[model samples]
Target: MATINNTPAKPEPVLSAFIKAKCPRCRRGDIFASPTYSLSGQKMHETCSHCGLHYEREPGYWYVAMFVSYAFNVAEMVTVAVGTYILTGSNSPWLYVSLLLGIIFLLSPFNYRYSRVALLYWLTPGLNFEPWRSADKPENPQQH
Candidate 1:
């Protein structure tokens, strides 16, 4: 019988985890408890319930998420503004501003969620579970 020792696995890259929406650890279980929003518009859970990974290391850790969120918002605004201008050739500032505000409000929650997850995925990549079966097994064990 071979004795197996458990060891923590290497962390995943931030961008990969963020894009895949996988847990920062195993990359198997989902990070969000429920992808759907509640009636009250609050997220169900901030952490990965399946793997017990904390989404926010600290309260202010998510402050950087604002940058990510802002980038998303700006990109959306640019796209909308360009599309509107091209379609209508409108020069009214109020029209563009109103349209931008409406789109931002509608997409705020999504921006918030993605920004948070991206930060977490990047900042704390190793904070995940490594199963013994996968971590302990030799890549090519020789049979005697």
Candidate 2:
């Protein structure tokens, strides 16, 4: 009979996990309460449920997400500008500007959460995913 180990596997392609707000250390654990766009779903677990990884390194850490949020906002605006121009074949500056503004307002909440997730996953130094680093826990006698 074959025996199965008990250690959890490591998360991969950290970027995608970041987008989904999964734990950078172990993608198995979710960071956010909700995956979809919501007006009141910004809560995050204080520590990783799977690996005990800390979510916030220090006070004011999330403030750094402002830059990431700005970047996402700019990317969205440019996308809207190009899409509007290409589809409508119109060069009116006001049309693109108005559309960009509207989209920004609507996506602000998403941007806020996603940007923070990005900062925590990609920008935070010293923090990394070590597949071999199991959560500090007692040994299970049921496992081989």
* TM-score leader: 2
- Runs in model 2 with CA error above 4 Å? 1-16, 134-144
- Single out the weakest 10-residue window by summed lDDT for candidate 2: 132-141
Off by over 4 Å in 1: 1-20, 44-46, 123-144
Q: Write the per-residue lDDT of candidate 2 for residues 1-144, one digit (tens) a residue.
A: 111385544435667777767777766577777655665666777887867778888998878889899999989988888889789999888888889889998898789788877887779998877654333342444566
**lDDT for each residue of candidate 1 in 59-90, tens digit (9 for 90 to 100):** 78778889989999999999999999999999
TM-score of 2: 0.77
Q: How many backbone clashes does candidate 2 have?
A: 0
Model 1 TM-score? 0.65
Kindly give the stretch of ten consecutive residues in candidate 1 with the minimal lDDT sum.
132-141
For each candidate in turn, give its C-alpha RMSD to the true structure in angstroms. Answer: 7.3, 4.9
